[model samples]
Each structure stands twice: as structure tokens, then as C-alpha cells.
Target: MKKKKISLGDWIFNIFLGLFFTLFTLICIYPFYYLIINTISANDISANGQIMFLPKGIHFQNYIDVFKIPDLASAALVSLGRTVLGTIGAVLGAAYLGFMFTQQKMWARKFWYRFTIITMYFNAGLIPWYITMRNLHLTNNFLAYILPAIVQPFNIILVKTYMESISPALQEAAEIDGASVMKVFMKIMLPLAKPIMATIAIFAAVGQWNSFQDTLILMTKPALYTLQFLLYQYINQASSLAAMIKNGTVISTSSLATMQTPTSIRMTVSVVVILPILLVYPFFQKYFVKGIMIGSVKG
Candidate 1:
């Protein structure tokens, strides 16, 4: 086949589209880049807004100081623990319920499915929610994070739709053999539903990793503090310390390179908290769009 020549209008349109997207991409990326450069630059220079577009007075000491902060390791562990455990629980629960809902013989299936989906549209109010958590004795409990997220209705819907698009013959064949329901789910549906499951897992993991509101309302123990909540505390403390150092009321024990300021603390903590999710995201990104599209095909 001969190549078609591009028209002037088409070329102009393509150029405009490319420029628009480039500007949009830069807009999205620049804020994170700004935060990183600010954190790595000298406190005085960064405070003066001298560093932009590129870092000045490059140093890794802000990260070092952030690592040295009290309970940071523990808080990170809490965040990681909740994210991993909660994501696993959510994926499994949603997968099982989604598969079950697709079964024609399931008792009161429509009612239960409708009941679950109703939650997405309604809230019982914050006070009632807090009281419910307290009543369940989940306050200051790690289960608070895992249990509540395990049965997310939206995840179940996605998984259900995705599974519905799979060949029912595969499931029926398994049932015709000596395979049990659990075995069929494990050996057949679950493996086939990997894409959508990965999508749900990513959703659950990000939500779990970023969540701090539950920690604020449900936790009283420092030991259970999440990385995000601790970052909030660090920002407040760093502000006070920055003010004190400025007024000459406190002397710096660390060198100029490792000094902590509110801006540095805030940006460093944000990077620390955000980096893991960012790193994990690309691995699941391949399945993400495919999963959402296939899962939305039914309804």
C-alpha cells in the first residue's frame, strides 16, 4: 500500500494535540519535581525560593535527617503492614464475593449484591462511624485497617464484571469434573481473573498506603501510628523547631547539611511516603487499563 500524504490541517491538529499533552504532562510532573529539588537543596536557599527547575546546593542530608526522626521506622512498618495485609484481604474478599455473585444458584444473590452496592452511595455520618468502630473494638487495632477494606463493593463489582466476561464454559467444565466450588474458584476463576484482581489490589494498596484519617480517629497508641500521620506530626514539630532555631532559642546539633526545616520535613516526608506507591504502580500499570475496560463492559 502507498503511504498517504498528511494534509496541512491534519499536521496542524497533530502539532497542537502534542503541545497540549506536553504542557499537561509537565504540569502534572513539575510539582513533584519541585518538591524533590527543594528537599535536596540547602535550607536557606530553598527557603529563599532560589531553587527552581533544578536543585542547588545538592545534598542527601534531608533524607538522612528524616530517617533519624523518632518512630519513623515503626510508622513506616505500620503503613507497610496495613497496606500489604489490607490489600490482600480486599482482593481475596472481592474476588470470592464477585465470583459468588455471578452464580445463578446463589441464594438471595441480587439482594446481597444490591445491599453491598448501597453502601457506595450512603454514609452513616462520621460520629456514627466512629462509634461503630469503637463498638467493634477496632480502635488502636491493626485489624481496623484490614477488616474494613476487605469487602469493598466497588472492587467486587469490577471483579464481578471482569469475571462475567470470561467464558462460563471454563467454570462449567470444572464443575462437571470432580472439582469443588473452592477448587474451581482457586484453579479456574482466580487465575483467569488476574488482570482485574491486580487492578483491585492496586486500588486497595494505594488507598491503604495513603490513608491516615482512620488512624487519627481510631488510634490512640503511638505504636500504631501510620507513616502519613507521623509525617503530619513531623511537619508540625519541624515548624516549631524551625521557628526556635530562627529566634536563636535553640542551637542546631547537626551540621548545616542535615538541618531540618518545615519545608524540608514536609517535602521529604511526602517523598518518603509517596515513593513506594509510585514504584509499585508501574508494575501493575500494564493490567490497569485493560482490567478497568473489560470489567466495565457489563454495566
Candidate 2:
């Protein structure tokens, strides 16, 4: 076989493409990297904006001091609890409802699907929503986080669109084999829909993990406080919190350079709050791309 030689234009375009993407990748990555380096760098250096592009005087004391705040552990536990439970509920609800909408045998399928989607575009405003949640006794309750977000209309639509792309012959074949709808859905639809499910799981998990407004409005108990909400409070009170930490912790001469500061506290908390999502994203990225691309094309 003969190899084809590249044209001058092709060679230049390839070079341009490589450089463009390299720059774009750095643009996306550098902010998080900036946060990381600053958080771990010496407090005085970070505060003075002297640490850029690389860290100086690296230390883990920022993380240690941030973790020392009262109720941080419990708040983190609550956030983790909501993220796991809410993601599961959201994925299952979206999958089941999406699958059901595809079935002609479902009672008033078109009407119900339309009704569900309508809620996506229309809202009764904040006061009514707050009143509604209050009526349901969700205030200051842990279930406040999970129950309200279980059935997201946009996620359902994505799931339905993805499932519709699957050949109906598969479902028909399962039915012909005397498989009940539940059995088919559990054993067949779910397995085949792993990509979309993974996509939805990532979306739900990020949403649940980063949620702050819900906590602000629905929860009043310290026991129910989420990590993001706590971070929010910390950011608003960064100076006082930093002062408190600095004053409370004994500052030995050796540790003075790495001691806490308002800027360091903010950056450290941001990193701590976002690191889990960053770590979890790579595992689901392949499925997320496949799911979103296919769903968009199918829709």
C-alpha cells in the first residue's frame, strides 16, 4: 500500500488545530489548578498574589484548618448523603418515567408526558414553591433535598429521547418471550440504557452536591446543613472565620508562613467542595459524551 502525502494546507490546519486545543485545554484546567496551587501555597504568598503558575512553600495546613471548623464533618456527611440518595432517586425516576412514556400501552401516555414537560417551562414562583414545600412538611427535614428533585422533567425528556432511539423490536422481543414489563425494564431497558443513566447520574450527583439554595430556604437545622451551604456561609464570613481560626490555632514560628488567611480559607474551601465532583467526572466522562451526543442527535 502506498501512503498519501499531506498537502501544505492540511499540514498547517493540523498544526493550528493542535495548538488551539492545547490552549483551550489549559484555559479550562488552569482555574482549578490555580485554586489548588494557591490553596496549598504559603498563606502570605497566596494572599499577596505572588504564587502564580506554580506553588511556593507548599503545605497542607489550609486543608487541616478548614476541616477544623465546627460541624464541618456533619455538614459533609449530610452533603454526601443527599448526593448519593438524590442521584439514585433522580436516575431511577427519570429512567422509569422515560421508559414508560415510550410505551403506547401506558395510560394517557401522551397527556402525561406533555404534563410532565410543561412543568419544566412553567413555575409558580418562589413564594408558592416555598409554601408548597412547607405544606408538605419538608422544612428543616433531610427528605427536603431528595423528594423534591426525584423527578426532573429535563432528565426525563433526555431519558425518553434516548430510549426512543433504541429499537422497539427489542422490547417487543422481550414481550414475546413472556417477559413482564417490569422484568423487561429492569433486565433489558436499564442494561441497554447505561450510557444515558450514567449521564443522568453525573448530572444528578453534581446538582445534589452543589445545591445551596435549597438548604438556605428549606433547612434551618445545623444537623441538616450541607457542605456547599456551609461553604457559602464561610465565604460570606471569610474574614471573621479566618481571624477565628488564626487566633484559635497556636501559631508556632515554624508554621507562621502557612497559617490561615481569608483568601486561603476561601480557596481551600472551594477546592474541598469541588474536588469530589472533579474526581468523579473522569470515570463517567466516556458515557457522558456518548449519552449526550446520542440524545441530542436522536432528539
Candidate 3:
């Protein structure tokens, strides 16, 4: 094959494009960079706040405070459980139901499918939503985290589209061999649909792990709070505590002196909260892109 030489104009454009994106990427990353430095640096907390770029003094005590905070350990456990259970529940439920939607034999599948799709666009608002959860007795319940995610329409639609793209002959062959619908789904479809499942599972896991609004809305008990809600409360406490310090209500001579400043602790909490996702991402990186693309393909 003959090689086409790049024109000077093309060379200029490519260089410009590369530089533009490089700057944009750096800009996007700066906030996380700031967060990292602030979280790890001890001197920055007590210093005159002059330094922004480089980490001032290293300290793990901020992290210690995060772990030691009241109700936080329990909340961390809840967040972890919710991420695992809620992700599995949402992915399996959505994938199974989505596969069922592709089956012609399923009763009222169209109406039911349409109903679920309608839910994607509409909600009854906060009051009715609260009432419904209350009636279900989900208020102040751990089930609130896992149950609500089990039937996400967005995940269903993604899985459905990907499943529909599979050959119908696969299912028919299983049926001819005396395989039940459940067996076919369990033994065949589930295995074949790994990519899309992984993709949506990532989505569900991240959402479930990060969710705190539901806790705020439904949970009154401190024990029931998720890590995120605890973090939220910590941020509020940070502001309130700062106000107390400024007003001299919380004297430096008191126990507050030994306590990690709310700002430092808040940053530590952010790092702790996101650390799981960071660890989990590398495992999913290979399938993540493929799953998203394949699932989005038209059936």
C-alpha cells in the first residue's frame, strides 16, 4: 500500500488537537489532585492555607479519624453490603427480566415492559414515594438499599437490547433438549450475557455504593445511615464545628483540640468512600467498554 504523506496543515491541526485535549484532561484531573493532597497533608490543615499544589506534611491520622468516627464503621459495612447485594440484585433481576421480555411466550410481556419503561420517565414525586416506602415498611430498614435497585428500567433496557441480538436458535435448541425456561436462562443466556451484565453491574454498584439521599429521606435511625449519608452529616458537622470554633464556643483548650478538623476529616472521608471504586475499576476495565458498546447496539 502506498503511504499518503501528511500535509503541513494536517500536522498543525493534529498537534493543536493533542495539546487541547491534554490541557482539558489536566483541568479535569486537578480537582481530584487537590483532594488527594488535602487529604494526605497535615500541615496544610493547620498552616496558613498558602500551599495548593504540593502536599505540605504527610499524615495518616486524618484517615484514623475517619475510621474512628461514631457510626461510621457500621455505615461503611452497610455501604459495602449494599454495593455487593444491591449490584447483584439489580443486575440479576434486570438481566433476567430483560431476557424474559425478549421471549414471545411470556404473558403480557409487552404491557409489563411498557409499564417498566414508563417508570423510567415518570415518578409520583417525593410525598407519594415516601408514602409507598412507608407502606412497604421499608423506612429505617436495610432492605431499603437493596430492594429499590432490583428493578431499574435503564439496566433492563440495556440488557434487553443486548439479549435480543443473540440468536433465537440458541434458546430453541435448549427447549428441544428438554431444558426448562429457567435452565436455559441460567445455563445459557446468563453466561453469554456477561459483558452487558458486568457493565450494568458496575453502574448499579457505583450508584448503590454512593447513594445517601434515600437514607436522608427514609432513615431516621443513626444506625441505618450509609457511608455517604454519614459523610454528608460530617460535612454539615464540619461547617457547624468551624462556626463553634470561630465563636469560641468550642475552646481550643477543650477536647476539640485533639479532634481532626472537620475539613481534614471530610477530605479523608471522601478518599475512603471512593477507594473501593478505585480498587474495583481495574477488574472491570476490560469488560467495561465492550459491555457498554455491545449493550447499546440496536437489536
Candidate 4:
């Protein structure tokens, strides 16, 4: 059989599509690039909008200033601990709930599934949640961030959907081998569900990493502050800036000339906050892509 040659129109259309997508990608990425550059560039240059794709005058002093904030390192440790523990809890809980929902013989499965789904669309507002947390004595505790969001309903549904697509024959074979429910889940189902598990792990990790509201509301103790909440406090406290000035903290006069140039500090703080997650993402990049592909097909 003679292979058909590419049509001119199809070639042109593809070329146009590629160019369009390239431009869109650049448009999306440039703002983050600009923010990164702006944070490192001199305050004067940033204020004048002279910094764009490149740093105008390189400086590490903003980062130094950020570090000098009291207990910044401790706050970072707290955030890291919370994120790790929360992600693990959520992934395990969601996976178990998802697997249970997938079982044909599970009693009242429809009622349980519907109950979980209802939580996805509705939430008891913040005050009521706060009151409940207080009643549970979770306020000002690390568990405040962990316990409330451990079983994400949407994640459960996603995992369950993925689980439902697994071959029934495989499950039956496991049963014939006299495997218990737990063994079937751990050995057979979990191995087969790696892609979705990876996806949920990433989602849960990122959500915990970026979470601020829960920490803000439930944790009032300074020692328990997560990175996000600590950064927020640093940003809000005029006294921090005033104390820096009073202590003769080595801020450039050029930076001080425009006191508000600490906007760059905000950008820098964001980069710092997200840097760990960025580093961790590449390790899971393959699994992440696989997970999305599997999820889309199953969902």
C-alpha cells in the first residue's frame, strides 16, 4: 500500500496550532518568571518597573531579611511536618474509603457513597467548623490542620472511579487464593491503582503545603504556626518592619527609600514557600502524568 502524503492544509494547520500553544505557554509562565526576577532584583529597579525577564541588580538581602524574622525556621519545620503527616493520612484514608466503596458486597454502599459525595458540594461554614474544632479540643494543635481534611470526598470519588475500572476477574482470582479483604486491597488493588494513588498523593501534598486558612483559624499558638500562616503574620505585622528599622537591620537605603518595596519581599516569600514543592514535583513527574492519564480514562 502506498502511504498517503501529508496534505498542505493539514501541515499548515498543525504549524499554526503549535505556534499558538507555544505562545500560550509563554504567556502563562512569564508572570511567574517575572515575579522570581523581580524578587531578586534591586528594589529601585523593581519599583521603576525596570526589572522584567532578568534581574536588574542581583541581591540576596531580601532573603536574609526574611530569615531574620523570629522563628522562621521553626515555622518552616512545623509546616513541613504538617504537610507530610496530612498527605499520608489523606492518601491512606481516601484509598481505603475508595476501595471499600468499590466492593460489590459492601452493605449500604450507595448510602455511604452518597453521603461522601454530598460533602463535596456542601460544607458547614467556618464558624460552625471552628466551634466544632474547639469542642473537639483541636484548636491551637497540629492536629487542627490534619484531622479536618484527612478524608477528601472528591479524592475518594476519583480513587473509587479508578478502582471500579479494575478487572473483576483479577479480584475474583485473589478471592480464590483465599486472600482476606485487607490482603486483596494491599496486594492486588493497591498495586494496580498506582497511577491514581500517585495522583492523589500529589494533590494531597500540594493542598497541605499551601494550606493557610485552617492553620490561621485553628492554630493561635505562635509555635505551631505553619509556613503559610507565619508568612502571613510577618506580612501583616507593621511592627516587624518597624523593629527591623529600629534594630538597624542592614536594608539598603535604596530599598528603604521606597519602604513599600517589600512587595518584592512578598514575591520572594512566595518563591521560598513554593520552592520545596517544586523540588519534590520532578521526582513524581512520571507518576503524576501517568495518574492523570489513568484518571481521565476511568473518570
Candidate models: Cα lDDT each: 0.89, 0.91, 0.84, 0.82
Cα RMSD of all models vs. native, in order, equals 2.8, 3.0, 3.4, 3.5
Question: lDDT value for candidate 1?
Answer: 0.89
Residue 203 error for model 2, in Å? 0.7
TM-score of each: 0.88, 0.90, 0.85, 0.87
Over the stretch 1-299, how does candidate 2's per-residue lDDT look in tens digits?
A: 99999999999999999999999999999999999999989987888899889999999998887787789989999999999999999999999999999999999999999999999899999999999999999999999999988899989988999999999999899999999999989999999999999999999999999999999998989999999998888777767756766676645666556867789878998899899999999999999999988777754
How good is model 4 by TM-score? 0.87
Looking at model 2, which ten-residue stretch has the lowest summed lDDT? Answer: 248-257
Off by over 4 Å in 1: 1-23, 245-258
The residue-by-residue lDDT of candidate 3 on 1-299, one tens digit each, is: 99999999999999999999999999998877777787777633543454488876666666766677798879888888989999999999998999999999999999999999999899999999999999999999999989989999999999999998889999999999999999999999999999899898889989998889999999999888898999887777777766666787866553442445666766677887787897898898777898889888873
**Ten-residue segment with the worst summed lDDT in candidate 4?**
255-264
Q: Give the residue spans of candidate 4 off by over 4 A.
A: 1-18, 237-260, 296-299
> What TM-score would candidate 3 get against the native?
0.85
Tens-place lDDT per residue, model 1, 1-299, is 99999999999999999999999999999998999999998876777778889888789898887788799889999999999999999999999999999998899999999999999999899999999999999998999999999999999999999988999899788888888888989999998898999999999999999999999889999999998998877778986878777888756544544577777888888898888998999999989888988998884
Better of 1 and 3 by lDDT: 1
Using TM-score, give the best candidate's number: 2
